[model samples]
Target: MLVNTFLPLPEFITGNILWLAKKGFAITLFLIGTDLSLKVIKTVGIKSVLFGVILWAFISILSFIVITVF
Candidate 1:
């Protein structure tokens, strides 16, 4: 946003870059998903997964509270 205020990018260039970035991100996620397997999940164990879920929930709720309070 700041950069655009000083020297705005051409629409065509920004569009192309955004298109490329989206494609790259999709491909990266695809590769990562392909790498994940049941074996890996089994190794991580249910306990770890539950812990992660709880931690994520805690952080998300805390963030929401902070955002609303401020």
Candidate 2:
């Protein structure tokens, strides 16, 4: 069940990257805005941000391993 929830992540990421590439500077600005927002949120006592970052790192590493292995 948990694995199923994340099954579409790679596809989602690929689509997002393609969309970003197509949009060029606009997408870059959006991503930068999101980063700034996240930083502000973290500064405002959002402790879960660290956990989210760790989770993202773990999932990214797992995805890399799966891709390399196959």
Candidate 3:
């Protein structure tokens, strides 16, 4: 939606947005990789792994709700 606000933006800023979009994918991938690595490090056994996964899912959902609401 924010991206849509910039329809017909001046060329320079438009280019910047395109560049940011490209870089954003890389950033997201890196973050996901780091998160998985941390989970691997913290895993103890099957029970702990399940709890960690559930906790991560809950946190992710909460974050999504907060971002969308705000």
lDDT value for model 1? 0.81
Which residue window of length 10 is worst by lDDT in model 3?
36-45
Q: For candidate 1, which ten residues in a row score worst on lDDT?
A: 30-39
lDDT of 3 by residue, 1-70 (tens): 3765866667788788789988998867965876655556556566776786799899999999999999
Q: Rank the candidates by lDDT, best first.
A: 1, 3, 2
lDDT of 1 by residue, 21-48 (tens): 8999986796486685567769989787
| Per-candidate TM-score against the hidden true structure | 0.47, 0.42, 0.40
The C-alpha stretches of model 2 lying farther than 4 A from their native spots are 1-35, 38-44
Measured on C-alpha atoms, candidate 2 has an lDDT of: 0.73
The models' CA-based lDDT, in order, is 0.81, 0.73, 0.76
Model 2: which ten-residue window has the lowest total lDDT? 1-10
Model 2 agreement with the true structure over 1-70: per-residue lDDT tens digits: 3554776557777777768767997756965866757567667555666676689899999999999999
The numbered model that scores best in lDDT is 1
Error of 3 at 48 (Å): 0.3
Against the true structure, what is every candidate's RMSD? 9.5, 14.8, 10.2
